[model samples]
Target: MTNSNHQWKKTALSVVLTASLLGTASMPSAMAASAAPEAAVTTDALKAASVGQASGTIAGTPLLQSYALTDKLQVEIKSLLNETTSEGTRIAAVVRVRSSDANVAKIPDLELRVKTADGYEYPMQASVFNAHAIRPGTTEELNFLVKVDRRSPSELTELVWYAVDWYSYPKKETVQLAVPVKGQEWTGPLSSFANSASSVLPWERSFTLSPALESPLVYTPVSVNRDNTPQGPVTTVKMRVENPSATKEAVPDFTIDGRSNGNGSTDKTVFPGKRVEASPLVLEPKEQRYIHFAIPTDKDTVLTNFNVLTPETFRQLDPKGQPSQVSYNVGRYQVALPVTSRTAEFNAAKPYEPGQPFVFDSLSDTIDPHLSVSMVEFHRHENEGEGYQTVIAKLLLTNNSDLPVPVPTFQTKLITAQGMTYSGNRQTGAIAEIMPQTSYAVSYAFNMPTENEDEQYVLKFTDAKTAAPASTTIGAYRVAMQETKLDVANMSFYPFKVKLNDWTLNARYNVPSALSPNTPISYTYRMKLDMDIARNEHVVVDPNSSKMQLELVDKTGRILSTKSLPFSGVNRLISGPQFIQFDTLRTEEHEYPLDINIYEVITTPTGEAKRLVGVLKQ
Candidate 1:
């Protein structure tokens, strides 16, 4: 095998560790060596210190500017310095890295120290490196701070920058570079959260918690009244539990018990003001959930630390040979977070507002920092038939976290001015994957009351993942009309055409008598489509782009209701012959005149959008 290939294999351990640590690897020996220096030396005296340089490229990567560590890794010293302080002399170094291969790289652990001729080593006090994953062929920087005795510089014979590569191969630990004093702060995006709780599980299970364990119960200050009742002051702690165990073991719950002191007192207090989480509390094997609790306290009284509990139930054979139920706690777990502070902040936000986009203003997943939702482009549309209308909305979902989670769907409702409510239809998009840092547009269609035009309505979005209650309001909007009389029902609309042969008038079978203001309510519509548009080409419809509008009226042409339906439910890919169903409307009078307008969108060869307007009168 080639030497390069061998080196790559040898370095695999370091590489995996770097990735796991998110580029913030640490070295115990290096950290322990950073202690008080024994001697001191002036700046001029350190100027004569010995400087070492790499003889040649080490690991395929060239020693372009400074130290060479391995075949694929090299460090370029940016600056170094030594300054005298009241307690001792401080040494600092600024360095960056260069890698030869295309693999992602990170400098999780880098340490620097000065070794005097007298066998004393002054280790770096703090080292901050850009721990972010670096694309191969790119460089990452790190800053180091060290303190030593002023006299140590005079006897300093070597300054070393320690490094280990991705493969866990210990590279050259000592290399010489010019030292100049400078300070740097580590400023990089925080690493994504990863829970390793499964490793410490008492029994085999699929999930873990972000904070593997809780802190030992601690004391916090609280207030008490003259009657000894706990008053103001409260402490809170947050925790996340993740399920990554086998599928069968995925159902789990987290709980904290509030047992009373049983002191035979009239006040049967069970950790007064202790709040418990509500749950069936089962999670998918790979799901992570969060919870928090607050305890009221007073400086004069100490609240008891509640016992954390997680129960699992099973159906099994009993000693009597009959199937029986059994429940048990996972372990004697304690709360991991502390309520050391006297009080916690609780910020309350409004839940609903009209005339604005509907936003569920809470994180969907307790453990994930990404995946949120917003609803926009809310409007009203009138159907072509009498007494029917629908509200159309666009859902703009976004993901800013590194985890590529499935997009979530929200339950929605439309509240009319008369206090009546209606439900929306499910118009799913063709989205399969929600990549990080990307957004998807989802469409929603809500059936509305016919008398709601020119009157305000409330649109609300509810996320099943969150308990926060919030809603968005949409104001009264004017329903506009666009019409064009077609010469024939068989006319073509760029990508599609309407078929006049399938036209028919049918009774509104689903309308209840109470909802029908007149007798013989009926619906008029046609099977609208032309199959010859694309025999081989595929029709791709974006959920956010296409729409269907409808308006219903009485015999005298009095407008009843208006509604709109976005083409969000259209098949993502269409080929061969496809049929289109026009809006279905319900009216009390069967002989009312109908005005139908079909708006179809087609993309031209150059990507220009063309709208096909077809109007039908019966």
Candidate 2:
């Protein structure tokens, strides 16, 4: 025989013998015992032949084929993806390891590398596996990332995996697998792959509560939407989480695989998923709330199947009154993607009109102070020299419950149909207390651009005191300005019953303007009011409130000057003759008929105008 042929035959014989010994080691106890002596002899002969023969590389295994690192541990590469990032080219391999032993399997220190066709091997940059132990009959998924420097060859040819012995340094079992790179290239920015556009299928998952509780917590997906920002694309997932248990239940921590880079690198390669809105740590008993998660991603990513991990841990007192920690594996929920409908119903916001009531059943379990927004008034005014417009919202709140309820503060916002937002500038009104079955009015002044007067506006309210769920929108009302005109014979306002007995107007010359001395001698117009006033017992009127205001207007309904009726206190509205002085007028003003406006001004203890109640135009 030729020397080359002899060497090839000997190498083939050694490989066959080595394979037999490895197979014997994995057999059942009875079969392994029967072949123990023969396997030992074969192992010795194979080792002797391997010493003299040239070291040959192992053949590459196909992707997804299971390979044995030891008799108890099995591993496979489920998927591979390559992405281009600003820092470098990233090759991510999704690896899964399974243990079939009766005892716990100690995972060996693992090393992974990406081998290119040009003989370049890039070492693993990071891994998701942080532990070294795996329970019997359990499986764990790991993400292995290999980073190639910028401009390096990215044509992946093989995946080189090594299992190194923890005790014996530098000794490792290596395996090479052929990579199918045709469709594995991400071909875009790393953010695009991580933030791929995906939707949750219609799904409802239930988790058991504490042992003391009877009902389970229900979780359902409501909607998914993508928004583009200057930083990147944010994909938000809205979920409806409900706790039907009689006892308060803690909110479980939720995590999604692939939502984070998990590269364990210092570089800010990717951002982690975050809860979109502020959430309460615990769900009140029988409380249902909607939560949102904002994840960063791209438009091209498709999420076929993903796992949501929810593990809940809490401390509970034992029967003996000793505290013990209890952990419940809420479980990893596998969600299928690309669904059309949601399983849970998303509550639609009910539109309200001015003066319509938006009733709130309960603010909390113990504080069921049924409150309602009985009336809403929109008043628009232009600042003469400030170059802006002021929109005032007069809200009348009534307490329907028997107990006195303190008025709730709200984070008020005025939104337009064109997506413009104006924050409330100042709030005024009696906010101390609302008597049982009584009504109190408050005003929120929003200063906006003059050009926005024509836009459709909605007043939105969010609770400012309690840390309510973000989805809890107290109310939204359409702001439509209406002019209230009353008959001159019968003049009566809300929260008060009064009669306009008689009135007289007299004009007098007042001091001239300092800046325009030759302009004209201004006429000081005074009107005396005489009437019988009867107060509404169900109204919460502040003691230090101011009197009704009077405005002299032009023919076009533009207010020319304003003055307040002289009154001692709110309780004595009809004490004696009250005069309203409009001191800004010219001699030419007496020729044209002047229109008068009456406004009820509610005030706080410090004399700040709380609200401009009702308007009566004559």
Candidate 3:
């Protein structure tokens, strides 16, 4: 599976694409079009040896304009590569899309960007026509890759694409039939592991086979570390058997397959085993072991060879001794090594100052046996626009384990004391299930570093491996940006005063209403609860804690009517003036629009409990 549907599974920064295949064609009105559909030109003897140019636009419209493809499919853009290598400057492009529609057509969810007149935009790490379901009149071909670093090639230029103005091709009970599997082949000698400070390259590979009577069978390999663990970026490997010889044998347990080295060809089978005892492989004489086979490795996977079957190498490559077994032309041997993330290291270990906590009781089975992370707050906020700056943290997670703990998937970074590692921009809260000893409060808003030099600013929690990180410095000074305005007026009722515990709390608001038709509004409010400082701090005002809301819209703000009001006191002691009245109903010529909201939850003589909000407007 060259990129077996590209296998994306990190789950938080998003970028997953590889799904195309499902056919049935017939809608050719000359390939219909009114505009936005140009970029199929490559004939001047094939565009004079082309090197670039495929035009784009899909929500800015223009590809030539005109748009109508609800299942007669027919998209264009054919070629465009910007190649520059050495470790950067690679941008490939090709978009086909062909269907005729007679009952099979689909291509929803689309996005691709590549602009460059020197404005730089490049987005599309993966997702767009990877072939899994696009079969109607047949003509799939959607590939796009981006790398950029050797200085963006030369300002590159043009190749945009986007879809969803009403996308089409999804009906056969909502389509889902791609069926294309066949990828797992091998030749020999191949073992790659990327390096040069891009870190993560811890490898190990061994071999020795001799089936058919079963005598020799070494095969070592262990390196497991699902990257930052969460089962993402995967790297597995596992398989350590031996038995160099001396009788007592049965063998039989190999199975492993992978493929991807150019032009994507996904063969499947990425670590699926069960022969250590689910039967077979008896070994006992010199018995040496470790099986339960595994192989994973999918984030930019590049195999091209990794087939390792058994049953006496499928009965000595059969020709006559066929005891039967046709698992795909039967497998035998092919394990050239090429799994990626060069092994795996997940760096991060030098820069501790805000209360040290980058711990990981070392994953006691997976994420420290389920929950207990830490890092209780880290501030720094200012300069939120134009150049950027804002940290704000608070990640406490605590589930103590009892089932209901699943919060593994993180990737935060801010480092920089000259080590540089910025990268924190999509953390809109996600825990998906916590409940056990209970405690879940995750709130991070990172975005600081402005091109370096604020000195320390660490704040890294890479993947909270199992919680142990508490502070990352970042407290040099900067947290001034509080704008909370709300003081409306047109006088129907308005008043504001906040000074709790030291006295003074007179809040009033009864405004918001203008566009009558369903009319009948009445409001009365007043409050005075003071024990002068103590009469046992007098308390008595919980008419459901006083809260009122009424809405009746029709000026297009939707909302026919809503009402609320209830104040029930249970007492602690109190003496004063409290009058709350509420009645609503407005309807005159049906102009609608009449809203009012008021809340008051008080109790302060030193008992603390407050909730106030009412800024009248009409």
Q: Estimate each model's TM-score.
A: 0.27, 0.53, 0.20
Candidate 2 per-residue lDDT over residues 1-618, each given as its tens digit: 374354334333333344464431122233335445655656665565455332422111112334555567766554455556567765666556778899988976667777766767777644423347789998766655555677653656666655556566666444422222332333332323222222122244332322112235666654454444465665555567677778898665664432333333343343335565454468889888766666665544433333443333334456997756533222133344334332111212345655667654232222234767755456664454566667766667788988888877665667776555666643555457788888876666677787775534666665433322222244555565645445444443444555666677666665568887787645667778776766656566444333566767767767677866534454355635776667665335553466666655543222333223334333
Q: Give me the displacement of residue 118 in model 2, in angstroms.
A: 7.6
lDDT of each: 0.41, 0.52, 0.38
> So what's the TM-score on candidate 1?
0.27
Residue pairs with colliding backbones in model 2 are 195-297, 195-298, 429-610
What ordering of candidates by lDDT runs from best to worst? 2, 1, 3
Which candidate do you rate higher for TM-score, 2 or 3? 2
Q: Write candidate 1's Cα lDDT for 1-618 as tens digits.
A: 475455433334333333233222222232213311211222233333212111221111111133344556665544344444456655554556668767886544546676655676777644322344567887666555555656433334455655535465554353323221111111111101122221222211122221212211111211111111134444343344455454523323445433333443345333423223565455565555544445444433443334344333334445887756433332222222223332111111133342233333332333234655555345554443545665565556666677676756555555553445555554555665577776665556666556666444455443323322221221122222223355444543322343443333333443538766665535544333322222112223354355433344455666544445443355432333434443444444454466554444322222212233455566
Q: After superposition, how far is residue 212 of candidate 1 from its true place, in Å?
A: 20
Off by over 4 Å in 1: 1-363, 366-372, 382-389, 398-405, 413-425, 434-439, 448-460, 465-545, 548-618
Residue by residue across 329-446, what tens digits does model 3's lDDT show? 1233445554434212212234333323345423123344556655544544334244655554545667777777776556456554444444554333434677677655454555
Candidate 3: residue 305 Cα off by (Å): 7.5
Count residue pairs with overlapping backbones in model 3: 53
RMSD of 1: 23.3
Which is the winner by TM-score between candidate 1 and candidate 3?
1
Which has the higher lDDT value, candidate number 1 or candidate number 3?
1
Whole-model lDDT, model 3:
0.38
Q: Which one wins by lDDT: 1 or 2? A: 2
